[model samples]
Target: MLDFAIFAVTFVIILVGAVLYLYPSSRSASGIPGLNPTEEKDGNLQDIVNRGSLHEFLASLHGQFGPVASFWFGGRPVVSLGSVDQLRQHINPNRTTDSFETMLKSLLGYQSGTGGGATEAVMRKKLYESAVNNTLEKNFPMLLKLVEELVGKWQSFPKDQHTPLCAHLLGLAMKAVTQLALGDRFRNDAEVIGFRKNHEAIWSEIGKGYLDGSMEKSSIRKEHYESALAEMETVLMSVAKDRKGQRSQTAFVDTLLQSNLTERQVMEDSMVFTLAGCVITANLCIWAVHFLSTSEEVQEKLHQELEDVLGSEPVSLDKIPQLRYFQQVLNETVRTAKLTPIAARLQENEGKVDQHIIPKETLVIYALGVVLQDADTWSRPYKFDPDRFTEDSARKSFSLLGFSGNQACPELRFAYTVATVVLSTVVRQLKLHQVKGQVVEARSELVSTPKDDTWITVSRRS
Candidate 1:
């Protein structure tokens, strides 16, 4: 009886080992150590859903498997680089084109390519940069006006009233992007409100649907999402038609019209930019203020810097660069919050990271969340210390993470400028205080925001 029991145990062990060895090799195209698909068709998709978000799943995946890892995203094998060295190997400095466009378009279900050839893409890229430059340089007063209005509203609130910080920031961001990118049509309160409603519907779905195919599964939800997208596109199309053939680069749509892109291409680009711009700007401000509210020292330092740079004067574009400490705090907020936690670029040619060979057309994910909080890369990485950004090594790590110098995306560049202006304006006037016993937890979606509506009260500073 003892001999028979031993044989049964040995047989079960052998079977388990065989399945582990054979099954993963079927899905894992490279030698990169990571997860295999639990199911054949869905790949590691359900795993992502179970783990909360793509960012969370990647964090755990990299924790188990070293820096460079692999996982099946649908049928395609995805290679994720989670450390500075791995990211350096994957990013190409010569390639100045946008990397997130393809991934974003895929998630949004926008099928049209950004023109047909490489030349067309390059033309569009130049026009995009021109639009951003023109929007900031030519329309500085409009941005300042918007910030003043927001601050005025905050001041109107009764002293010690707990203001809903996220809602206000989201509204301000919507107004800023729609007015600056689209046109004055969005200046109407009704138009801005309607646009915000649709933006919320689409963005909420895009974040959820990217992880699970649940949005498409329900006919009602699928129709509602498509309807919201169509409505936003219609608004963009009208704006484009109004600006067609006009040489003035006042708004983003006008600048794109100056190029040879088809109206459809122009509309698509505008939608992508508007969607990305609003979410990023809103959450960036939310996290920055929330962090500052928790730390009085950080707030005092920012206030001191504002006094040193511009005493009792509002922030201007020319003066933004001189406020180095303010920029450092913003940079630190981005790192600590993992604001835009993930970004991806498709490898067109076969590439090598360390010893692993990446096949052509493989999707390479930059796991920015894991790298942002890596202990080796940043000391006390989880703590909200802006001083860490003052070091050369810390700056290099952030550069490798793609938030510095020429690597920052246009939307981020826009957000940084807007945030600098907004945060500086508010901190100089009012002191932000967190509501007692209110613990804000991050809900990592396309952008990391507080899981619930975050609230803070303001007291006029003396």
Candidate 2:
């Protein structure tokens, strides 16, 4: 009797599994939407996976499937929306706190039980503003200083030895952002630098582990990540302790410390701020230099713009907006290399785009890289053209892809300020030339960065 009962249970489980496996994912009652029979026949799992790098695979789907396309990413249903009209209709005006908060918790390994309502609200508000205002504003001077340090270092080194543009840019970006987020006291301080280095290594390895599915099974990288986190926390905690009795400064660290929140909240917020700010700016700078070096005409035009506006003076924040063509060059670079190419958000509730229904809990990804390069949207999509972002074009709502509306990166406004300042300063003083036989390929990870070290020779412009 027991053997018969086990056999019946096994049979039911197998039947249920079979049913689930054969179940149609489409919401349509007929288990088939209006997709063309031919197209459906041709669409296969391999084709979906081969669309592009994981970052751009979704946009390729949208390109093939019109404005709305449903696909799977490793068993997870992903919906991609291409049209700005559809995106505006479906994605905007919703609070992203739940998604954003979840990401924060996961990345930093924080428990959800930490903060009260008021504390959480304050932390969120501060984080939002830090993404836009204080972080960027506070970091501008530091960015300038770091650029100067880089220039001095470059000038000191012999031109024959190739300058590792990628590494230097990363270091500079890391320094500037860390200073901005953690305060000047911790920017390059010994303990902070150690923590930053370890954290970067751990996160870099973790990204690899994630792609290879090893993070769960291995403790090596995870251990490093935890160690780095602890060190970072120690640093932040010390800073927070020191600031406990002090008057509030406008720094992000100060803002975080002063908020009526737990110590862990302060540390987690600072860690996110530091990591996010550094990677984006670093990748942007490296790509900007690569593009400027490869295209002499564009570089000349940018240099002329810098000369006309600032005229050999050190580039400053106040002078950034006036550097029109320089700004366009940066915009074009961003378009060419969508730094954060894809953004992922889980649907809070069911949403629809035209005929298709995006069920709740699906991951909705906006593929900025593909959208920015769409042939219909950008003329000569493959060409590097800064003029595409002219004031008129930008004002007319042509999607240039620096930052998306509603889903825009909170830190981009600040990133623009730092990037413009750095680019203008570098171009005004130096002539950048690509190293011989070294072709820079863009690498897409958490951000899009150069695959190999970007080497360039810089000489004082005569």
Best by lDDT: 1
RMSD of each: 9.2, 8.7
Model 1 lDDT per residue over 1-462, tens place: 000001111112222232212334465668778888777655677798899887899999999998999987556577888988887777753143544554566566564265457676556656776888788887789999999889888888888899898889998899999988987888899999989989989988876653456765688987898899999998889889987866566888888787777888888889888988899889889999899999999999999999899997778889999999988998999999998777776667788888999987666777888888988798998999999988999998787666876656678888888899888989888888989999888877667888999999988888
Which ranges of candidate 2 are over 4 A from the true structure?
Answer: 1-52, 73-76, 83-85, 93-105, 111-123, 126-132, 135-140, 157-160, 187-189, 247-250, 391-407
Model 2: per-residue Cα lDDT over 175-240, one tens digit each: 776677666576556855675686686557434444333454568866876777677678778877
Best by TM-score: 1
Score every model by TM-score: 0.90, 0.80
Error of 1 at 66 (Å): 1.7
Worst 10 residues of 1 by lDDT: 1-10
Clashes of 2: 0
Candidate 2 residue 47 C-alpha distance from true site, Å: 8.3
Local lDDT at 445 for model 1 = 69
Q: Clash pairs of candidate 2?
A: none
